[model samples]
Structures are given as C-alpha cells and as structure tokens.
Target: MYSRSFNIKKDLAMRNEFAKKALDANPSHPQTNYDYGLALCNEKKFDEALIYINKAIDMDPANKDRFEGFLPLLFMAMRDTENSLKWLLKMSERDSHSRYLGWLSCVYAHIDDLDKASDYLKRFLDERPEIKTLSDYRKVAPAIAKNL
Candidate 1:
C-alpha cells in the first residue's frame, strides 16, 4: 500500500526534482520553474536561486506575484534589502494592503531608518491588524527572530 506523505521538506525536495525533470521534458513550464526557485530559496541558495526565479519572471513578466512578491521577498530574506526595495518600489502604486511594507519596516529598522521603519510598521499593522496584538513577530520571520 502506498500512503501519501505530507512532509514539507520532502515535498520541497520533490518539487525541485520534479521541476528539473519537467523543465527537461518541456522547456517552457513557468510554474515548474517558479516552484523550483521557491524551493531553492527555502534551501538558502539565493544566488543560484535567482537564476530559476528570473527565468520564471522573464517568461511571464505580467505575473507580478513572481517579481513583486516571491522573488523580492526571498531577496529580503537574504538581506539584499536594496534589490528588495527596488522591486518593492515597483509594486508601491498598487492598491489594497502592502506586503513588502513589512520587509521595509524590518530593513529600515535594522538600518536606523527609524522614521521610515516606524511608518512601514504602522502600515503593516494596518494591513494586518491581527499582527498588532501579537507578542511575537517570529510567527513569520522565524530565522530573523533566531538571530535577534
């Protein structure tokens, strides 16, 4: 009997391998490429990671989620705040709550940009009210909290 496995680490590895095989079989599946990049980012291979992530975006630049959210979010995790901000700035004009604002808040705070950090944190709180009352930010940025 074959049972389904629900391990994220295993799934992530499977996704990476499946992505590689899928790309080899059909060189234009953007979703597979994007999944690969996400896995690579999760594995902490940011530099080599960008190659696959860029391929996905280049294939479909209209997919703002790739460029504006996932890719830049990974960059922010890698502490590439400059590039992170660049991509985040490209998304600033959009309506609705801000996703990158949280990254900005943390980076700006790290860099002594108190005014901007404070501003971003407020915006982040507005966008996610539940986050305001929480005693832990680590529910999201666990690696960062480990260092702090």
Candidate 2:
C-alpha cells in the first residue's frame, strides 16, 4: 500500500513536470493547458487546476461543452457539491454521453438525494446495459462510484 501510494505520487509529479514543460513551450495551446490542468488535478490542487482548465476552455470556446465535463468530478473531489451539481446538471442537459447521467447520480447520492440519484442512475444504466453492477460502474468511474 505504501509503495503504491508513493509510486502514484511520483507518477503525478512526473506528469506535472512534463505537462508544465509542454504548457511553457506553447502557452496558447488549448490541449497543453488542459493537460497541465489535469496534472494539477491529479495532485489535488483544485484552485490552480481550475485556472488552467478554464483558460483552456476560454481559448477554445467551440469545444467548451466537451472540455467542461471534467469540472464536475474535479469539484466533487474538492467536496464542493454545489459546483459539482451545477456542472453535472449543465452537462446532463448538453452532453449526449451517458456518463454524465452516472455522474449526476453519484453527486445526487453524495448529497443524500436518493430519489433523484436513483432516477439518474436508472437512466444511466438504461443507456449503458453493460454497466450492470456497482462494481462495473466503479471500473468506469471510481471517484463517482465511491460516493454511491
């Protein structure tokens, strides 16, 4: 367990370094900013991560909806359910993907809104027949699943 945790930290540090170098080389690049933001998120630096992530979204407004999907989970990790719900609700309305339904369910569950959570969870499962169990859901979204 200790070794696994240490290796995870080391990997995140390496990721942050590489992403920082890439962002420095091309600060205007949307993908580079997004990648560095993701690295910061992996390190649990939520505020700094948002700055880069939002910058990336602003740089490429055409793909804003797609780019913003990660925000709900990031906010969930920060224990900011209000923001998480805000993004999840936004994505649920805009995104065609089924995962947002699952995320919505997870956030609802986290907030003790079981009726809404179950409704979203059912919708998610209906869309994704392959995800038949909590274990299967965890495989696809461990962070969100853990809340359930």
TM-score of candidate 2 on Cα atoms, chains taken together: 0.80
For candidate 1, give the lDDT of residue 120: 92
Pairs that collide in candidate 2 are none
List model 2 lDDT by residue over 46-70, tens digit each: 8898899999999999988767978
lDDT of each structure? 0.65, 0.80
| lDDT at 15, model 1 | 57
C-alpha RMSD values across all candidates: 4.3, 5.1
Q: Give candidate 1 regions above 4 Å deviation.
A: 1-10, 64-67, 140-148
Candidate 2: worst-modelled 10 consecutive residues by lDDT:
1-10
Score candidate 1 by TM-score against the native.
Answer: 0.74
Please, what are the lDDT tens digits per residue for candidate 1 over residues 1-148? 0001212445656655665566677668676666666666646787777887788788888884745456556666677778877766665646344656776787788779899999999998888776754464557654523443
Model 2, residue 54: distance off in Å is 1.0
Residue 93, candidate 2: C-alpha displacement in angstroms: 1.6
Positional deviation of residue 38's Cα in model 1 after best superposition, in angstroms:
1.4
